[model samples]
Target: MISKKAIQIFSVGIIAPLTLQSCQQNAVTNSGDADTLTGRLVITGSSTVAPLVSEIGKQFEGENPNVRIDVQTGGSSRGISDVRNGIADIGMVSRGITPEDDDLSFHSIAQDGVGIIIHQDNPVDSLSDEQVKQIFTGEISNWQEVGGEDAPITVVNKAEGRSTLELFLDYFALSNSQIKPSVVIGDNQQGIKTVEGNLFAIGYVSIGTAEFSVSNNVPIKLLPLNGVMANGDNVANGSFPLSRPLNLVTNGEEDLLTQAFINYSQSAEVHDLIKKQDFVPLSR
Candidate 1:
């Protein structure tokens, strides 16, 4: 069933306070028709956060005709790198920024959880935390070992530089080297597609993304983590164990357009946009 819970969630581990109000007065007016805002903004990073941000960007553009927003996705690390290197005006990061990353400013727009996913036909409904760890580590190589059909488990892992991979490694007490992956995917959709195409494949992705895909009739199942159901409600309520903040990042004091766009993304105006993407939006 689709979750009825509001996806709005408070951002945890904020490195700095976000400036919500846009400084339109201080902004340099673009040379244009003189009535509409005009400028180009580039945002890049986390595939998980890209779609929601893109939707928000479209709305912002409609309100300000000449303003163009370009959204790109690689991984959270790429978002950090591009913003820090001044290539992108803003970056999308799916995980929280720690003190070690104090150089850049973080603006949290939403929250999400990472959950295990498998083919819909897989008979194994659940696995113990230890079993999940063992399976990824290659200690349990076959589905039969976990009460499923007798077939070798094809592990799907996220590629390096993706926050999902880092969070999964941390939660499972593992290093990337410990995993025996049959395939390495770049984003949530890719991971979902990988598992959907292979009945014995197991993977992980944003619970919000998984929920959205499942609602769209995607042939994949989000396995329960431990005993908790993996759904948007659990993620919004903080019951899900592996939730992370979805953030927009800026390296330093941003230009007027960048600041305005970031402010709009975090504002209550975009809550529905976040909800449509199945991510928890920032609370009032």
Candidate 2:
């Protein structure tokens, strides 16, 4: 569901709509010959935002033959640093830019929420926010304490530099140094797999990513936070309590190709693609 705000931005062509209005412009832009616009645009950032942005890049490349968009994932922090240092043409950040972020420009691409996950066999369907915080902080170390098995609780945490880790920590008002993780993972699937393979393990990741994997029999369940369901529908409807913006950041001036790609990402054309990847599209 694209937001009405995003639709207005896209309609007015904040950066110019990807849909050129005239057959003549299309003829020139897609002349069937090698486009004069040839450049490699590198985007590195959040694994959460990577899949959707990669899809956008692929679609954009198909329309403009000579443009090559390379998308990579490390974490949102890496994306911020890489773009600021000119190591990347664009940074895919799953979180908002801060006031101290040197005033870089960003385009909101989508929205996602951080969610807790546990093995499917675990009977505990949800935990209160305080309980979640205590679990990560090592204050609650046994399943029985949380109405589960008598086994010890295995905590899976995200590694440093990952935005997932950043948000999880912030949500619980915790510091990285305070968490006691039995295992640390980098991406959503890594965290999910860790929880899936360990019946007593509890971890967190993107709700959209986790839902997609669960539908495909990933053997995991999303834990409710503050008694609210963690799903795309809840997130889009603003009923989900925990959520974050997905963005693409550029340090300064962008080349024509880079700007065009950004416009394409923000356009209405990729709304379905964003949904296909289990993320909420910007408002239409």
Candidate 3:
């Protein structure tokens, strides 16, 4: 639950907008009263960050009754583009902001890990980093080669423009052209579902999303990455090798309402919401 101070921080001293700006054009609606904090924010970006942000948005709206938040998912790239192009009030980006995005303000709300996942029914508990690379590269097409039951491996890869895909390819030292995938997924849930339905399928997704699925009795396992467990605790402590920040990005200077939401999202008030999504909240 959010604290009173946290809610007040976003609700207090917010005057209604008079004129439409680039970010405010048609996206925000205001009540007639100047004292009321009434508006709508359109947030778009990483599918990985969408669910968590959606939950946070709901809580935020609950606190500030007059405000509305809309969260949409495409990929991390879309988030960056939408914010930069002023199509969205905020963008949910899962990866670290690169030098190319110097003009954008990135507010990191939490941490998550990218990890390899396979059906729990598979006997193979873990794979060496090299083995993972080989599997995706079609060098090891059969699960038997990795000590699993005899079956053709179903390779699940992330679609292009996804932060998960970029992180995965970088850590494994593989290129997109090198991957021979049976399926390409757009988001973490889709990847998790694909692996869940196919016993021989192997995919990668956010460790936080995978953990949340596992907790709900999903038939999937998050394999250790180079002997390190793929979980939020490991990411929070910096022990996980393939972790990335969950950020809310803004194109330029933010409106007062936008700034308030950003501050609340990063504050300790939303730690439980972050944990509920299996993500590691920023340290206070």
Candidate 4:
């Protein structure tokens, strides 16, 4: 039997919004009082980072009692845009900020790796980076070419605006226009489900997301990249080649509430929350 504490962790920590893709909407609510550390926090960005951020907000709200955090996700692009355009308090981005994003401050809250996933029964256990690149770019369309069955490969790709998609393309040095996909998904779970349901399908997603699904008996397997497995242990140890920072971006000048939340997100208390979401916490 699971204790209430463990169950609570599973509720907000592992599940909650971890598998959700948010609408193009902003939410606002107030908690506590203005006299205290109370304010409305509008968080918008990457669906991958939204779940962890949401969990942190839940714990922070429990402790502070005066802060309300409104978490929303469209993609990593939206998170960056929301911060730049002054529409949100903090933007949840799963990739490192490039030179183009010079206006906001980058605060890394966790680390995660992108994993190439296939159906569990696919028999193919791994893929070389070159093979992955070719498969996604439409150069290799048959599973047999990569030591799998004779079925034609069905590519499951992420939608535009997703940081996961951007990091994947950047790591492989491919452009969006160069790739052809049979299906496009918005979040990690969608991609997982698509691949799980189709034996011939293949997709890349957050390793944390994939691991969580696998733990729950999801019919998917993560294919190693360049002979390295996509797991949090490897990612945390810096052995995983496809790891990316899960960041929270704020304006160079931020408010008191925003600052507190950022600090709380990086606190030791939130480390379990990060792990529960299948992400690696910063070394304590």
Candidate 5:
């Protein structure tokens, strides 16, 4: 006759092996194909879309430890050219490419609002589309002429290859004429800084950078276009004329990693992330 202690010990010994085996199986299952993906993905494009793409790259890399994503911000045209020439696997753009970009395939990932921002100290609250057109085209040279203080208007513009510059020129039908040489040309961040530091300066920037300007207490205000405020809701409803689709262009032949990135971008998990980055999700 076996004692109770002996029987208990026998039961424990039987269960422990099964429990260990179960855990080992789970570990193997959980680790399935996680190491199968390994390579570098190069993404380049609009400085306007850089922050959002950077965030996506960070999160995606965290999940797939074997992959590396490199992100660079060259102006939008450069991005399109890079992808077309196979310099990058992904190219982000704030504006759409033309038929000349036929060799490259584009995926619209998000939407962005372009707003004319002024120093907060400036009392001008709004401007009609015509007024904005005139201001950027150098037709309006004085703040007082537009109901602001008695100061000369300083127009800050993005560099020649930038998407913002192209958008502004197209929106105002100034494509045939070169941007006034007198306009101060700067990169995305520089444009924001210039407007913030100069009380009479006005510039155009994506909503993301504009939000950063506000957060940094740059004393800047986003002016309405055509009397319609440039906010997420207005942009979504097409009420904001300056709103444009942001894109991720590739060679169009889908690969595992490219598909993975696209899937991630279209996922619900990334929708809020897109919004937090101050852009509207394409899904919405």
Candidate 6:
């Protein structure tokens, strides 16, 4: 049996979004009165970062009592747009900002290893980067060609606007290559579920989501990239082909809440949380 203290810590630490809206509202109201700062903080971006941000928001609200952090799951592009338009305070992304997003300050809070995933029953254990490029670019249509069970390959992809999709395309030099129209587009969870349910399907997801999927006994396996496994050590060493920075974009000019959150993110407490969430914390 789990100890009460352990269970409590787990509840507060891992089971996220700790309180409902009513309690949140009260906490916000009290904190606003005490700090004399009041407003809802909007954070939009990568569903990959959603759970982490949401957990942070819960903890931040618990501390501040006044600021309400509203988190949303739009793709990275939309998140950037929201911040640029002053609709959001922070934009979370699994990829770096483009040249056009020069005005907003980009803070990389963590690193994520993107993994090529397939159903567990699928015989393939690993893939070279070139083979991955071929598979995603529509060059390889049969699983047998890549040492997998004989079946037509079904490529599941994140939506076009997603940072994961953009990163994979750019990484593989497939930016100009046309993807077959049949590519299934979905969010991270859906992408994992689709691949888990279909033996012939292949997809990519962040390490955080992959961990969650595997924890839940989802029938999916993370394929190594160019023989290097997708893990924190490989990601930190730059051996993982799909490793990318996860960022929290803010206005360069620091504000109270923004600075507070940034400081908190670098704290030891949150660093452990980042690790528990299966992301590589940014080096101090």
Question: Which candidate wins on lDDT?
Answer: 3
Better of 4 and 6 by lDDT: 4
Candidate 4 is scored at a TM of 0.87
- Compose the digit string of candidate 4's lDDT tens values, residues 1-284: 21222111123322334322232232333445544676557787788888898878888878867556777777788777767777777888999979998878999999999999999999898889999999999999999999999989999998887888888999999999988999988888789989989999999999999999999999999988888888989999999999899999987877677777898898898999999999999975
**Model 6 Cα lDDT, one tens digit per residue, 110-169:** 898888888999999988888877887789989899987778988887766778888877
Q: Report the alpha-carbon TM-score of model 3 versus the true structure.
A: 0.88
The weakest ten consecutive residues by lDDT in model 3 span: 2-11
For every model shown, the clashing-pair count is 0, 5, 0, 0, 1, 1
Quote the lDDT for 128 in model 3: 98
Alpha carbon deviation, residue 66, candidate 4 (Å) = 1.7
Which candidate ranks first by TM-score, i.e. highest? Answer: 3
For candidate 2, lDDT tens digit of each residue in 77-132?
87787787677778889887778676689889899998999999999988988898
Clashes of 1: 0
Candidate 1 clash pair list: none
lDDT of 5 by residue, 129-233 (tens): 778777767788888888888888887877677788888888878862645534565456777878878899888888767876687787888888877886777
TM-score of 5: 0.84
Better of 2 and 5 by TM-score: 2
Q: Residue 71, candidate 3: how far off, in angstroms?
A: 0.9
lDDT of each: 0.82, 0.80, 0.84, 0.82, 0.72, 0.72
TM-scores for the candidates: 0.87, 0.86, 0.88, 0.87, 0.84, 0.84
In angstroms, the error of model 6 at 265 is: 2.3
Q: Tell me the spans in candidate 4 whose CA falls farther than 4 Å from its real position.
A: 1-35
- Mark the regions of model 5 whose C-alpha exceeds 4 Å error after superposition: 1-35, 176-178, 181-183
Which has the better TM-score: candidate 2, or candidate 3? 3
lDDT (Cα, tens digit) per residue for candidate 1, span 1-284:
11112111112222112222222223446675555566666676788998888788878888887676667667788778877766677889999877778999999999999999999999999988899999999999999999999999999999888899999998989999999999987888889999989999999999998998999999999888879999888889989898899999987788767878888888999999888998887776
Flag regions of model 3 displaced more than 4 Å: 1-22, 26-36
> Candidate 4 has which clashing residue pairs, if any?
none
